[model samples]
Target: MPGALAAVSDPALRAAFREWILRVADDELVIGHRHSEWTGFGPDLESDVAMSSIAQEEIGHARAFYEQIAADEGSDVDRLAFDRAPAEYRHAALLERPNGGWEFSILRLLLYEQFEAARLGLLAASGQEPVASLARTLVREERYHSLFARTWLERLARADAEGRARVQAALDSAWPDALGLFEATPADGVLRAAGILGEAPEAQRPAWEEAVRPVLQGCGLSIPAGPAREGGRRGLHGPEFEEMLAQMTEVWRSDPEARW
Candidate 1:
């Protein structure tokens, strides 16, 4: 398939596509930072190295997506990734939240990896050239992310009563934010209308639920019933996000003109 930019000349559609891409990139960047927090602090040496690698892969993924947008807009990828205001980021609130505990981070990773795999599947089938091809390539790495998360989740859940309780508590706290992953935006409608996106994030919820429910249930964890915490997609986020973004962007912001 031809690149969406070549196939679809509509400026609005292109803008919407850029917005959607930003959301994907932002999710990766934020979650990658959160994952990096586990680098030296993981429960074990193997897990530490594994999570560090995952963090690098995720940040690399974000850079790839940002490069796509930068190519389209004649902008700089570093600026796109590091200079955006906190409210300008389109990532779900879940990714920006603090990594509370090993259980919390593991469960969050499990939930997110499943959603990401499904989202990438949609992108791969969208026939939007570089983006579609990129999505396909990403799935290769994402599979291992899903595997690591699931394996850790199962181990933590089965470790003992306290372990199970901790995992359950993390689920209760994270489920609402996870559901926030599918919050919709006006740009999503544009992508759907342009045929660049087959399904809006909200529309993908059922399948995501189907994919996650069994894994979570198998761990003996109950899915929490709470309202989806929305607003990140629309540029609303909490102070914690502000703090994290500051830390993430500190060096770049301090020396924007310097070559990294």
Candidate 2:
């Protein structure tokens, strides 16, 4: 692997960098789309507007990362984002699952934001050029996202037994998928070996769990016990992802040559 990203000349290393970038970008894109679904349906007017802003911010983050990859690969950002087949996306399954309900989305956001922060922290000082810088800035945004999720989580937990049970159910269902966020691929080894990823995804897992456990337990939620579900990193996904990809790509696929 090259010390300088601009001087990356090895095919395998370049491929690994692309894979790492796509993993982060795809997560943002898919989760952004999921969040956008709540645009006009949030539990309140303020929440509706706030979530809409966060959704757009997530999409913007995705575009930034995609643009970085596009610059290197001589590919356009939209093509990289919308032109890919469903099997080509590298996002975790946690993000691709449908937003089951307000409780579900809030729980998923709480879990994912913690993971995202841990991920960015690993990259913060990795000396990985543009991505390190990107991570530094993105982590700030994630703090707000985490805060929003936590506030709602606490509210629901304290509301009543029914509210607490609903949140607990959502957390149970989402825990396995959230664990999948750290499922490593072969490319992860390449990045770790090259010092591009300061730590392995597996190493990040305990920290992620530790960060979320206190808050979740305080809310009367228990972490699900089991092996993490996998396959999303390798592009395997379920019907929900297929439906999402269809809707996401519809406008672009309608006329590939048309300008947006």
Candidate 3:
């Protein structure tokens, strides 16, 4: 709403850009909530604090994106975030899945951070206004997230046979949904055609793979052979997402008019 999107005069282009922004915001918000679940339950004290900090940052990022859309629509970030129904969300299914365990959470974080970094890079080069500048600023914060995940991933993978096995199992389980992060939509095509987006969402997959594959392989993890899980981008989520959404929006739903 900082007039960043005003130059995109075409209604179709604006709609597509808004959808893309919502997708990014939703992804961050859902994953941030998932990460927050570990606040008091992390395997160790440092990890607990670190995950909490990461959760705050992710949610903050979500707010930054949501603010743009909300401002454009004459709404508020809290309304855009907490007022939406489960099926209205556009986050990848990978983010909504249960944290499972420390290893699972770490592996999930590793995958997501890599994907986010790549996507942000494309956004930075998109020649868009405030959004591109915002992407550049967000990239600096994301570096710590990547580093945290990588450090923990390596330690867990090399800890022992059981640790390595656990990490591997996590990778196998998460890979399919991780791939779903790049599931393409008409919005992606629209953005690409408008020159607002440098690459379609699906086209960013290889770059994400290139970034994550080496780090994962270095940790002795094998990439899983599975098809990408789809639907989240289209607002089709599983029951787990329903439950999470119910919990996430409970307070807001209880009193939508109340300021938090």
Candidate number achieving the greatest lDDT relative to the actual structure: 3
lDDT score of residue 228 within candidate 3? 98
Candidate 3 Cα errors over 4 Å, as ranges: 1-3
Q: Mind giving the per-residue lDDT tens digits that candidate 2 earns over 117-192?
A: 8877876776777778888998889889999999999999879999988998898888889999999999989988
Ranking of all candidate structures by their lDDT, best first? 3, 1, 2
Residue pairs clashing, model 1: none
lDDT of 3 by residue, 1-260 (tens): 36356667889889888888899899999999999999999999999999999999999999998987877678888899988778899999999999998999999999999999988888789887788889899999999999999999999998999999999999998999999999999998898887778887778888889889999999888998979999999999999989988898888889999976
Cα lDDT over the full model 2: 0.87
Q: Tens-digit lDDT track for model 1 on 35-94?
A: 999999999999999999999999999998888887766778899998877889999999
lDDT of each: 0.89, 0.87, 0.90
What 10-residue stretch in candidate 3 is worst by lDDT?
Answer: 1-10
The root-mean-square deviation over C-alpha atoms between each candidate and the true structure, in angstroms, is: 1.8, 2.2, 1.2
Q: Which residues of candidate 2, in runs, are more than 4 Å off?
A: 1-5
For candidate 3, report its TM-score. 0.97
Tell me which residue pairs clash in candidate 2.
none
